[model samples]
Target: MIKEKKVSSRFIYFFGAFGGILFGYDIGVMTGALPFLQQDWNIENAAVIGWITSSIMLGAIIGGALAGQLSDRLGRRKMILIAAVIFVIGSILSGIAPPNGHYFLIAARIFLGMAVGAASALVPAYMSEMAPAHLRGRLSGINQTMIVSGMLLSYIVDYLLSGLPATMAWRLMLTMAAVPALILFFGVLKLPESPRFLIKNNKLDEARRVLSYLRPKETLESEINQIQEAAEQEKLASQNTSWGSLLSSKYRYLLIAGVGVAAFQQFQGANAIFYYIPMIVENATGTAASTALMWPIIQGIILVLGSLLFLVIADKFKRRTLLTLGGTVMGLSFILPAILQKVIPDANPMMIVVFLSIYVAFYSFTWAPLTWVIIGEIFPLMIRGRASGVASSFNWIGSFLVGLMFPIMIATISQEAVFAIFGVICLLGVAFVRIRVPETRGYTLEEIESMEESRQAKQKSALLERAGL
Candidate 1:
């Protein structure tokens, strides 16, 4: 009766995007939890601290790869349900780990980390598959908006709980993820499996039924035909489209572009601000981490705003153009502080905070959301699962490196210098988009692959013409 009692399109997209909250909450929860962790556990070793923080990224690296392959075989919905279960169990276990259970805490975080990475990879794909081509960007963009909203929620929770005793406060912050994880579990159950996934698995009738709810009644037949034909052509091109074949020459460019954007999105140093911005603020202002609290809430608000803006215009512009514009502006935001510090060595430390806020504003609309959109939409159906997994793993790897290294980088060098390096990386990211990334706005996944094929053929023709006898 789902066809008759089907929810509105807004409900479907909102529920689909809910998984992102699981990832975002875990990401921001640790930021609030870590300060209390140091005080409650009396931990002082920098390496140990870095390990605890980065362990989630470590597990995420593994989980993204595993979920990619699992979603391919088991279907996206089932894999997502599995991830939600993992988050609940992990969060509950982390809540209880204290008083000489440091390793246990790390292990629990790894479990949650797996869930985070899986959701990060799966939700976008699921939404993109269900949405019509015209709405895919905005629908997939809902995932990013939910992600920042999750971050905002965690920050609000942290601020509200900042006054409680350290042990009780941090435990609550870490366990808070279970609430939304449970919500997503129940929510996804009401949804149909992705029509494309159903088609690929040869459940054509089921795909037709799902599309009856997802697409216009008149377009359902042609939509099914188009989806089926695309899968058929991809299957004929390569029967052995396993994870190992992603490295093949034909797919190498996509894998590279996808993974490159994913990695640089992290390496550009946005998370350093998210995870350790309080610490950065503490150092700059010569105050306790507690005093650094109000700023993150401000950040959370700006992040939510930028994501809201993305929701409005995501499908309105070409991907390459927006990404290029965002990167240039974000680069300037980072570098301008260093320039000011050099021009006046006694520049108000708060100037750095203002610049970082601008950076977040730019990030929310551009790299923050678009990276997920491109990763979800760029791959052909045959390799989407494994390729997205690989790309996501690289993203977590960059996140891990930044989380582990940033504290040390700040301890050893001037913080402005570190941000300047990130500025250079951002400018370089703009070049990567201009040269390597293709325009993907408003294109069907099948048509995107065909476009790539045509471009490759033209390049080959040009090479041959230049060497004509």
Candidate 2:
């Protein structure tokens, strides 16, 4: 039984976060495919390239919203299964899109975006629900690890396939997503539903069984009772909960904290580098696309290493501290590149990659993974699903705008100017974290919610005293 518990817990965590692999692969695959696709299609329009790259984010916005509503009604596990199916279908459609017609490819990518959006919102929530509070940060961070692993895998695929004919190379890079989507489908099929969900649905026996697989025998009963108590209160509060509940002044700080972290995670300009690094490198140094592909692999390795480090430190430190330090470093990294380019016009372009690596090192361990971790932790259970979805939409909104505008920005202003703008955003992110985001480490979801309520009460009392009430 002890061995079974270990195996079951490992299985649950691995597959629970496995959806991120698909999410990362789809996001990274485009980096390699775009260079070849542009050459093959003889495309020169920056807007078209931006559309092809960013269309998935647009779809993700919709997917995140829809999945949030549905997952609340259905279950986290079931929503993942549904997303896996969408992943398979979308991957195939994306691969088969015809040459010279951006519309079909864009449409297919948008279809795939639904799965990406769903995974973004679902994986962290699912993992958090299943994990013990002490381990939630590390366990939840695994989704990010899986995401970067998938990205590294895609970068390797892109590099390996770079030598093939342009059309064939990009096509194969996309179609390969189906393989993992199928794996996610089969893998998730056997996993138990979240114990929290079970308790919410009043399945006491099943919740006990699920918790047994996750928690030790000593704590299993107490954990289940705790979850039940939270669920009972959540059920009462949910009677008044709706999408509008997020806007209530009582919870608005939580909403700001969750959504601000998510939005800043993207607006820091990380994806802009991920999606267009080759182009940036090529335009800067006139390097061939094939040679430029090697850089992503280097960045991917750093990201993976940083993610590994995050697992070690995730539960040890304050979330706000890590984010503030990371935001500061990331802001500086971008700012230095922009400043150097302005100061010395003939500076080596490779320095941009160096600074970016510093940025990625901080991001992989900090804002990238912790955003989802905090989002999963901060919301009230009654509104976790909808609020998470809304936060995700804001995240994708940042991603979509960055993806679409980065190229246009590069074309109009210089790369240095664009980098400067991203740098400023990163610094602003630090301010937001310090002022608004709560310290969520080592707290249960119930505890975090209560803490937020207390914080809200304090703020209200302070306001009343100031108003002479």
Candidate 3:
């Protein structure tokens, strides 16, 4: 019998969670910074401001698409390095953008989107690959936590710099990203490449070395053996299939489920709130716009706390159950605001803020992190890169649509109507998760793959028998 080996949670946490910080920071930073950017850049209209806010997502759509293919070819570590470079460039360009040309700012936002897209795709994959089976959910959940933490940091930065002139404050906010980017670049360089990547590249010796560092010494050999077996299985599976096979009747359902979950997460209107909470607060409170902007920071703090709660409980509960419950909560949150807005027309500002706060908290606890963890862990390894890209692309596409149209929607319709639409979408999301998504909390990647292979073989055998072959 093979011996079981213990692993260090610290090593996994440090390396895995670092990438998430960037994700969170990027999410939080832009929301607060946008008000200052708009003021400084002379963007007076809401539509233009929305465009400026979403430009990064448009870039991210492209970046996420490229990340999967590139990581598949170049490996995860290298892709992260590339993302860091893009982030630095985007940050610097955004910070120093000339006031005369809005296009420069748009371009810079797009560049940052690319970096975010790449990191979103790669970080989870890397964390999933590195984590021990028992700790996979918790470890992967760290990515989301870091993302929340980053969002919180952005809020703090924006609050502290709220007093600065628009140009200097925005520049300082954007440039601060460089500090983390530098740290991420140098820190990642010191870490070994993923053993899975090494194994796929036919560097068995190097794979073993990396595994030794990743796991306890006693478990290294068994882990290496397991990885090799998995690599061989993946290679064999790839021999007959291409990306086209993802559409085959047998595999198509999984793709739909994966992509649907991803799309719904965005459609639930979480990001609409994220990208425009400052504006939303102003609308609700009739407070001076700058003071209203502090709402995003509140949103960020709640997000961090909610995500932390999810991390503690994620492995303990069924993913589908948690997702459904979260979705329902989110849907209710959206509807409450819409109802209050329509009924009262002039409700208390504190009441509006309280409901919005609850909405943000619900999103953080359930849908935000769970969606990512599910996407990263659900697919078989062979198609993981391509499939994850497809899912992430769908996510970005949904985010793009929401970001692009929310300004127009809010103008044409009311904020109540916009949120009402989101409420409906969240209800649909809850239904989708309830009906389609499977529980995958305790299963190892290897075990999940085995189940898929077994199912496929059984199907193939039945087909052959029916044909009398």
Q: Compared with the true structure, what per-residue lDDT tens digits does model 3 show for residues 1-469?
A: 3322434546545755777787667766777787777777766676777777788899989988888778878999899999988888888888888875678888888989999888887887787787777666576567788888887887888789889988888788887887788878877766667788988888887777667766788888888788789778867777867899788765675678789999999888888888888777776666655566667877887888888898778778888888888889888887887787668877786675677688788888788888878887788766775677789889999898888778778878777778878889999999998777766678866676566667679989999999999
List of clashing residue pairs for candidate 3: 24-147, 25-150
Off by over 4 Å in 2: 1-7, 131-134, 202-223, 242-245, 380-385, 442-469
Please, what is the TM-score per model? 0.88, 0.90, 0.88
Per-model C-alpha lDDT, please?
Answer: 0.85, 0.86, 0.79
Q: Which is the better candidate, 1 or 2, if ranked by lDDT?
A: 2
Superior candidate under TM-score, 1 versus 2:
2
lDDT of candidate 1 vs native? 0.85
> Which regions of candidate 3 deviate over 4 angstroms?
1-12, 380-383, 441-469
lDDT for position 445 in model 2: 78
- Considering lDDT, which of the candidate structures 2 and 3 is the better prediction for this target? 2
